[model samples]
Target: MNVLIVGAGIGGLSLALMLHKRGIQCELYESARELRPLGVGINLLPHAAVELNELGMMPALAAEGVETSALHYYNMHGQKIWEEPRGLAAGYPVAQLSIHRGVLQMKLAEAVIERLGAGQLHTGMTFDSLEQDEQGITAFFIERGSGQRVSRRADVLIAADGIHSAVRRHFHGEADQLRYSGRMLWRAVTEGEPYLDGRTMFMAGHQDQKFVCYPISEPLRRQGRSLINWIAELRVPQAELPTTDWNREVPAETFARHFDDWRWNWIDIPAIIQGAKAIYEFPLVDKDPLPRWSVGRATLLGDAAHPMYPIGSNGAAQAILDARCLADRLQEAGAGAGHTALELALREYEAERLPATAGIVLRNRLNGPEQVMQIAHERAPGGFEHIHDVIPENELNAISIRYKRIAGFDPAMLARRTTP
Candidate 1:
C-alpha cells in the first residue's frame, strides 16, 4: 500500500521511517523548500527513547546531544527545592536525551532519505486538500516555489502537519477549536558555561512566572562551553490572543525582569537572558481532545491529532508513540482491510493516548512539577530559612511521583511497557 505523509516534521519523518522498516511504501511532502535547522531544544524521555533506540539512532543522538542525569527544581531566589534522577539514572532502560529540535529532525530526515531515496521525500510541496474513495485517497498540493498545482493518489494519507494543520481544518472546519492557555512563552538559546551537573534540566521561579533551562549539547567541560536553551513564561493580561508562530521575536527585557534577583552560584540566570542570541515568543496553547481522528482512509497524527501543552516534554514523545502505533496497526491489517483498519487503529491510539494527554494538558495548567515552588511560597507566606521547615521531604517526593505517572514516565509504567 502506498502511504502519503504530510509536513515532514518529526512525526512525519518518524512515520516514514517506521513504514520503510515494515517494508511498506510511503512518500513525504513538506512545505519547506529545504529542511533548515530550526527551533531550540527538545527532551526525549525514556518512553520515546525506547522507540528511537530500536531504530539504531540512539548512539548518534547521544553524540549530538547531552545525556541528562536528573531534573532539578529551584525557587526564584535560587534555593534548591528538589532533585530527582532521570532516564537511565532513574532506572529506565533508555536515557533522557536533550538535543536541539533541528538536530533531531535532521537525524530522522537523513534516515528517511537513506532508506526511501530523495525523490520519495518531496520538498516544496504544500498540501492543499485531500479526497478519499473506496479504492484510495488523492492528496492535492501546490508547488511552494512556483505555485504550480499537483495531485498524488495513495492508499492512505496521514496528516502530521502540526498545530495549525490545514488537513485538520479541512476535516474539522475552521472553528474556534484552538484554546489559548493565557501563558506566553519566550524561548532562546545561548552559549554559556555548563551549570549544575553539566547536563541537568532546571526549573526555577513560581507558577505564574517560571523559567526552564537545560543544556542541549554535550558539554565541552574543558572549554566550559555548552548550548543552553531556556523558556520564560508569564501570564499575559490581554483577553484576546495572538497567532502561534515559532519565529515571532520577543524582547528579552520584557521577561528578563523576573530573573533579576536570581543570583544562583552555578550560573548567572540574568546574564544568560541578556546575552541570548535571539528570543522566539509563543503563547502556550492546546486543543480539546477530538472525538475521532480518522475519516475513511485519511487520518491525523502528531500535533494535528492531539496538540498538548509543551510543559511535560511530551509533544515529540507522544508524536513518536503515534507513529509506532499507527504503523503497527497498518502492518497488521493488509490492503483489503485498510479503511476499517485505519479507523480502528486511530480509535485505539486515541483511547490509550487521549485521556493520558488530556490529563497532562489540564494538569500542566494547574499543578505540574513546578507546583512545589508554589506550595513553598504559600507556606512561607514570604520567604523561608529552610525549605524543609515549610514543606516536608516526603510531600515533595509524592508530588514528583504524581507528575511522573501523569506524564507516562513513572518507573512502574516504563518497566511494563515494551514500546512508547
Candidate 2:
C-alpha cells in the first residue's frame, strides 16, 4: 500500500517511520520549505519515550535531550503541592526525555530521509485538498515557491498536519474552530545553573497564572550547567485570541510582571523571564474534539486529529502514540493497493484514537494532573502552611494516577501493553 502523509512534524514523521518498520511504503510532504531546529523544549513522558526506544532512536534522542528525573508542582508562594519520580526514576523502564521540539522534529525528519531514502521525503509542498474514490485517494498540493500544483495518489492519505491543518480545515470547513482559554503562554529557554536534581520539571502557580521550568539540554547538563526551558503563562482579559502562531515573538514585559514575586529559595522565576532573548506568545487554546477523525480513504492524526491543551505534557507523546496505533491497525487490516481495505483500517484507527484523545482534550481543560495545583489554590487562596493540610495526600495521588490512566501512560497499563 502507498500511504501519503502530510506535514513532516512529529506525528507525520513518526507515522512514516512506524509504517516503514512494518514494511509498508509511505511518503511525507511538509509545508515548510526547510525544517529548522525551532521551538523551545517539550517533555516526552515515559510511554512516549518507550515508543521511540522501540524505534531504536533513544540513543540519538538521549544525546540531544536530558533524561527527566522527576516532576513537581507548587502553589504561587513556591510552596510544594505535589512531587513524583518520573520516567525510569518512576520505574517505567524508560527515561522521560525533555528535548527541544524543533530538534526532535529534525531528528525524526532525518530518520525519515535516511530510511525512506534521500529523495523520498518532500518539502515545499503545501496540502491543498484531496479526493478519493473506490480505487485510491488523490491529494493536491501547491508548491511553496512557485505557483505550480503537484498531485499524488495513494491508497490512503493521513493528515498529521498540526493545529492549523489545511486538510482538517477542508473537512471541518474554515469557520475558525480554535477555542481560546483566557490564558496565554510566553515560552523560551534560559541558560543557567540547573535546578533541583538538574533533571527535574516543575510548575508553579495555578491555571490563571503559572511558571513552568525545566532543563532541556544534555550537553549543558554534562557541563555542570543547564539550558532551562520555561513558560510564563497569564490570563489575558481579551475575549478574542491573540495571534496563535507558535513562533510569534513578543516582549517579556508583556507578561513578566505577573511573575515578579514568583521567586523562591531554590529557583528565581523573574530572572528566568528576563534571561530569554525572545518569548514566543501563543494562546492557550484547543479545538473542540471532532465528532470523527476518519472519513472514507482519508484520516487525521496528531494535532490535526486532537489538539489539546498542553497541560500534561502529552502533545507530542499522544501524537507518537497515534502514529503507532494507526500503523498497527493498518498492518492488521492488511492494507493493500485496495482503497476499501485502507478505509476500513482508518475507521478502526479512528474508532479507538478519536475517543481516547478527546477524553484527554477535555481532561486537560480541567488541568489534568495539574488539577492538584487548582485544587490547592481553590482550597487555600492565601497560601498554604502545608499542602497536605489544604489538599489531602490521597486526593493528590488520585488526581495524578487518574490523569496517567486517562493519558494512556498508567504504569500497569503500559506494562501490559509492552509485555511481549
Candidate 3:
C-alpha cells in the first residue's frame, strides 16, 4: 500500500518509521519548507519509550535527552504532595525520556530519511486537499512559498499534523473547536544550577497557577550544568484566546510578578524566570474529543485526532501509541489487501484508540493525575501542615494509579508487555 502521511512533526515522522517497519511503502508530505529543530522539551513516558526503542532510536534519544529518574509534585508552599519513581526507576524496562520536542522530531525525521531514502520524505509541500475514490486516493499539494501545485496518489492519507492541523480543520471545522481554558503558559529554558535530582521532573501549584521545571539536555547534565525547561502558567482573565504562537517571544515581566513569592529553600523560582533568554507564550487549550477519526480511506492521528491538554505528560506519548497501533493494524491487513482492507484497518485502529484517547481528553480537563494539587488546594487554601492530613495516602495513590491506567502507562500493566 502506498500511504501518504501529512505533516512531518513527531507524529508524522514516527508514523513513517512505523509503517516502514511493517514493510509498507509510505511517503510524508510536510508543510514546512525545512524541518528545523523547533519547540521545547517534552516527556516520553515508559510505554511510548518502548515504541521508540523498538524503532532502534533509543540511543539517539538518550544522547539528546535526560533519562528521567523521578517525578515530584509540590504545593505552593514547597511542601511535598506526592512523589514517585519514574521510568526504569519505576520498574519499567525502558527509561522515560525528557527531551526537547524539536530535537526528538529532527531525530525521528533523520531516521525516516535514512531508512526510506531521500525522496520519500518531501518538504516544502503543503497539503491543500485530497479526494478519495473507489480505487484509491489522490492528494493535492502546493509548494509552501512558490505555490507550485502538485498532486500525488496513494492508497490512504494519514493526517499527523499538530494541534492546528489544516487537514483536520478542513474536515471538522466548526464555530469554536479550540476550547480555551482561560489559562496561558509562558515556557522557556534557563541554564542554571540543577535543582533537586538533575534528572527529576517536578511541578508546583495547581491547574490555574503552576510552575513546571525539568532538565532536558544530557551533556549539560553531565557537566553539572542544566538546561532547565520551565513553564509558568497563570489563569488569564481573557474570555477570548490570545493571539499567540509557540515561537512568539514575550517578556517574563508579564507573568513574573505573579510568581514573585514562589522562591523556596531548595529552588529559586525568580532567578530561573529572569535567567531565561526568551519565553514563548501559548494558551492552555484543547478541543473536545471528536466522535470519529476515520472517514473512508483517510484518518487522523496525533493532535489532529485528539488534542488534549498537556496534563499527565501524555501528548507525544499518545501520538506515538496511535502511530504504532495504526501501523500494526495496517501491517495485519497485508500490502495487497486492497482498499477494502485499508478501510477496515483504519476503522479497527479507530475503534481501539478513539475511545481510549477521548477518555484521556476529558480526564485531562479535570486535571488528570495533577488533580491531586487541585484537591490539596480545595481542602486547604492555606499551606498544609501535612499532606496526609489534607489528603489520605490511599486517595493520593488511587488518583495517581487511575491517571496511569487512563493514560496507559501504569508500570505494573506495562511490565506484562514485552519490550523491544
Candidate 4:
C-alpha cells in the first residue's frame, strides 16, 4: 500500500523510516520550504531508544547526544528529593538520550531520504485537508512554493503534523482546542561547565516555579566544554493562553528574576539563565484527548494525536512509540490488503495507543512522575531538613515507577518487548 505522511518532524520521519524498513511504499509531505535543524533539547527514554536502536540509530544518537545517566528532582532550595538511575544505567537494554531536538529531527530526516530516496520526501507542501472513500484516501495540500493547491492519492494518510496539525483541526475542530495550564516556559541552551557528572538531568522547584538543566552535547562534554540545555518555568498570572509558537524568542528577563536566588553548590541557575543567547517562550498547553484518532483511512500520530504537558519528557518518546506501533500494525495488514483491512489496521493502532497516551495526557496535567516535586513543595513550603521527613521513600519510588508504567517504559514492560 502507498502511504501519505504529513509533517516531517520527529514522528513523521520516524514513521517513514519504520515503513521503509517494512518494505512499504510511503511519501512525506512537509510544510517547510526546507528542513532545518531547530529547537531545544529533548530526552529519549529507554523504550523510545529501543525503537531507534532497531532502526540502527543508537550510534548516531550516541555521537550527537549525551546518554542521560540519572534524573534528579529537587525542591526550590535545591535539595535533592529523589534520584534514579536512567537508561542503561537504570538497567534498561538501551540508554536514555538527551539530545538537541533539531539535531534529532535532522538525523531522522536524513535517514528517511537515504532509505526511502530523495523524491519520496517532499518539502514546501502544507497539508490543507483530505477526503477518504472506500477506494482509498485523497489528501490536498497547498504547495508553498508555487501557491497552488495539489492533491495526492494513497491507500492511507497518517498525520504526524504536530500540535498545530491542520488535519487534526479538520477532524476534531472545536473539540480540539488547547487547554493552557497557566504555566509558561523559557527554553534555551548555553555553553558552560557541566554539573553533576556532566551526564545528568535535574529539575528543581515545584510545578509552579522550576528550573531544569541537562547537558545535551556529548562532543562538547568530551572537549571539557558543555552545551547545557535549560528551561525556566513559572506559573504565569495570565488566565488566557499566550502565543503557542515554539520559536517565539523573548528576553530571559521575562522569567529569570524568579530564579535569581536559585544558586546552589553544584549548579548555578542564575548563571545558566544569563549565559543563554536566545530563549523561546512557550505556554504549557495541551489539548483534551480525542475520542478517536482515525477517520476511515486517515489517522493521527504524535502530538497530532495527543498533545500533553511536557512534564515527563515523554512527548518525543511517545511519538516514536506511535511510529513503531503504527508501522507494525500496517505491516501486519499487508500491502495487498484491501481498504477494509487497512482501516482495521489503523483502528487497531488507535485502540492500543489512544487510551495509553490519553492517560499520560491527563496524568501529566497532575504532574505525572513530577508529582513528587509538587508534593514536596506542598508539604514543606518552608523547605525541609530531609526529603524523607517531608515525603516517604516508598512514595517517591512508587511515583516514579507508576509514571514509567503509565508511560509504557517500566523496566518489566520494556524487558518483555523484543526488538521489532
Candidate 5:
C-alpha cells in the first residue's frame, strides 16, 4: 500500500517514519520549500516520548532538549498553587522532553529523509485538494517552485497538515472554524540563568492571564546557563479572532507589561521578556472537534483532526500519539490490503483517536490540570498564606491525575499499554 502524507510537520514526519519502520511505502509532501528550524519550545509528555523512543529518537531528544524534572503552578502573586514530579522524575518509563519546536521538526524530517530516502520526502509542494474512490485516493498539489499542479495517487491519504489544513478545509469547509480562546500568547526564548532545578516547567496566573516558563536547551543547561522558552498570555477583549500566523512578531510591550509584577524570588518575568530578541504573537485558538476525521480512503491526523489549546503541553504530544496509533492500525491492516481494508483501518484509527482527543480539546477549554491555578485564583484573588487553605491537597492531586489520565499519560495506564 502506498500512503500519501500531507505536510512535513511533526505528525506527518512521525507517521512517515513509523510507516517505514513497519516496511510500508509512504511519501511526505511539505508545503515549505525548505524545512528550517523555526518556532520556540514545546514539551513532549511521556506518552509522546514513548512513541518517539520506539523510533530511537530519545538520544537525539535528550541531547537537544531538557528532560523536564517537575511541573509547577502558581498564582498571580507568584505563590505556589501546585507542584508535581514530571517525566522520569514522575516515575514514567521515559522522561518528558522540552525541546525547540522547530528543532524537533527538523530532527523528525532528518530521520524521514535518512530512513525513507530523500526521494520519498518532497518539498515545495502545497496540498491543493484530494479525491478518493474505491480503488485509491488521488491528491493534487501545487508545485511551489514552478507554480504547476501535480497529482499523486496512493492507497491512502493522511492529512497531518496542522490547524489550517487544506484537506480539513476541503471536507469541513466553513463549518470548521477556529474558536478563539480570547487570549493572546507571546512566545519566545530567552537566554538566562536557570530557574528552579534548572529543568522545571512552571506556569503562573489563571486562564485569563498566565506566564509559562521552561528551559528548553540541553547544551545551555550543561554550561550552567539556560535557554528559557516562555509564553505571556493575556485575555484579549475582542471576541473576534486575531491573526493566527505562527511567525507574526510583535514587541514585548504588547503583552509583557501585563506580567510586570510576575517577578518572584526564583525568577524574574520582566527581564526574561526583555531578553527575547523576537517575540511571536498568536491568539490562543482551537477548532471544535470534528464529527469524523476519515472519509473513505482519506483521513486526518494531528492538528488537522483536533486542534486543541496548548494548556497541558499536549499539542505536539497528541499529534505524535496520533501518528503512532494510525501507523499501528495501518500496519495491522496489512501491506497489500485493498482500498476497502485500508478504509476500515482508517476508520478504526479515527474511532479511537477522535473522541479521545476531542475530550482533551473540551477539557483544555476548562484549563485541564491547570484548573488548580484557576481554582486558587478564583478562591483567593489577593494571595494565599497557604495554597491548601484555598485549594485542598486532595483537589490539586486529583486534578493532576485526572488530566494525566485524560491526556493518555497516566503512569499506570502507560505501564499497562507498554507492559505487554
Candidate 6:
C-alpha cells in the first residue's frame, strides 16, 4: 500500500518514519521549496520519547538536545513555587528532551530520507485538493514555483499539514476557524551561558504575563554552546491572529515590558529579553476538537486532526503519537486492504485521542500544571515567606498529578505502555 503524506513538518516527517518502520511504502509532499530548519525549542516528554526511541533516533537526539531532569515553576517574584522530577527522574523508562524544533525536524527528516530514499520526498509541491473513492485516494497539487498542477494516487492520504493545513480545508471546508486564547506570545532563542542546571525546564510569572525558559543544548559535556529558548506571553484583547509562519519577526520591545520587573536570582529575565537575537510573536490559539477526522480514504493527523493550545508541551508529542498509532493500524491491515484498514484505524485513533486532547485543551486554558503558581500568587496576594504557608504540599501535588493525567504523561500511564 502506498501512502501520500501532506506537509513535511514534524508530523508529516514523523509519520513517514513510522510508516517506513512498518515496511510500508509512502511519499511525503512539502509545500516549501526546500526543507529548512525552522521554529524554536519543543519539549518531548517521556511518552513521546518512547516513540523516538523505537525509531532508533533517541541516542542522536540525546547528543544534540538537553535531557530535562525536572520541571520547575515559580511566582512572579522569582520565588520557587514547586519543582518535580521528570522523565527518568520521575521513574519513566524514557528521558524528556528539550531541543530546537528545527533540530528535531532535521533529525527525523534525515532519517526518513536515508531509509526511504530521496525520490520519496517531493519538495515545492503545494497541495490543491484531494478526491477519494472506493479504490484509492487521489491528491492534486501544484508546483510551488511554476504553478503547474500535478496529481498522485495513493491507497491512503494523511494530512499532517499543521495548523494552517490546506488538506484540512479540503475535507473540513472553509468554515473551520481557529479559536483565539486571548493571549499573544513572543518567542526567541539566544546563544548564552547555561542557566540553572542547564537541564531544567522553567516556568515563571502568571498566565496573563509569563516566561518559560529552557536550554536546548548541552555546553558542559561536548563544548557545545547552549541555546536558551524563551517565550513571553501576555493576555491581550481579542484580535485577528498573526500568520502561523515560524520566522515572522516581532520586535522584542513589544512584550519585554511584561518581564522588566522579573529580577530572579537564577537568571536575569529583562537582560535575556534585551539580548535576544530576534523575536517572533504569535497569538496563542487552537481549534475546537473536530467531530470527525476521516472522510473515506483521506484522514487528518497532528495539528490538522486536533490543534491544541501549546501549554502542556504536547504539540509535537501528540503528533508523533498519532503517526505511530496510525502506522500500527495500517500495518495490521496488510497490502490490498489499505483503504478499509486506514479508515478504521483513523476512526479508532480519533475516538481514543480526541477526548483526551480536548480535556488537555480546556485544562491548559483553565488549570494546567502552572495552577500551583496561580494559587500561590492568589493566596499570598503579597509574596510568601514560605511555599507551605500559601498551599499545602498534598494539594499542590494533586494539581500536578491532575495535569499529568490529562496530558497523558503520568507515571502510571507511562509505566503501563511498552516503549514504542
Among all candidates shown, the one with the greatest lDDT: 4
lDDT winner between candidates 2 and 6: 2
What tens-digit string does per-residue lDDT give for candidate 6 at 1-420?
A: 899999898889988999998889999999999988788889998888998998999999998888898899998998898999888888899899999899999998899899999999999999998888888888999998999999999988899998988988887787999888778888998876677777889998877878999888764425645688898888886656666664479888787887788986779889888888889888788888788888887888888888887787988888888888888878887866755676887687777777777777778777488888788878885689989988999998999888888877889988888744
> Residue by residue across 292-353, what tens digits does model 1's lDDT show?
78787778888988898787688899889889888887887765565667667656766676
* Candidate 2 residue pairs that clash: none
RMSD for each of the candidates: 2.1, 1.2, 1.2, 1.1, 1.0, 1.8
Q: 1-420 in candidate 2: lDDT tens per residue?
A: 889999999999999999999999999988999889989999999888888999988899999899988999999998999999988888897889999998898898889888999677988999998987888889999998996998999888999999999999999897748998988888999998888899999998999988898999999999999999998888877658765455699998888888899888999899988989878988888999999888898899999999999899999999999999999988987844466677788898999998999999999999999898888889999987888889889988899999999999998898888888
The ten-residue window of minimal lDDT in model 3 covers 238-247
TM-score of each: 0.94, 0.98, 0.98, 0.98, 0.98, 0.96
Clashes of 3: 0
What's the true lDDT of residue 286 in model 2? 96
- Please provide the root mean square deviation of candidate 1 (C-alpha atoms, Å): 2.1
Quote the positional error of residue 11 for candidate 3 in Å: 0.7
TM for candidate 6 is 0.96
Q: How well is each residue in 1-420 modelled by candidate 5, as lDDT tens digits? A: 899999999999999999999999999999999999999999999999999999999999899999999999999999998889999988899999999999899999899988999999999999998887888989999999899998999999999999899999999898788898888888999999999899999999999999999999999899999999999888888656865455699998877778888789999999999999999988788998889999898999999999999999999999999999999999999988987789899999999999999999999999999998889888999998998889889988899999999999999999887785
Q: List the lowest-lDDT window of 10 residues for candidate 6.
A: 217-226
Q: Is candidate 2 or candidate 6 better by TM-score?
A: 2
Residue pairs with backbone atoms closer than 3 Å in model 4 (clashes) = none
Model 4, runs deviating above 4 Å: 243-246
Residue 321 error, candidate 5, Å: 0.9
Ranking by lDDT: 4, 5, 3, 2, 6, 1
Candidates 1 and 5 compared: the better one by TM-score is 5
Stretches > 4 Å off in candidate 6: 219-225, 238-247
Which segments of candidate 5 are over 4 A away from where they belong?
Answer: 243-246
lDDT comparing candidate 3 with the true structure: 0.91
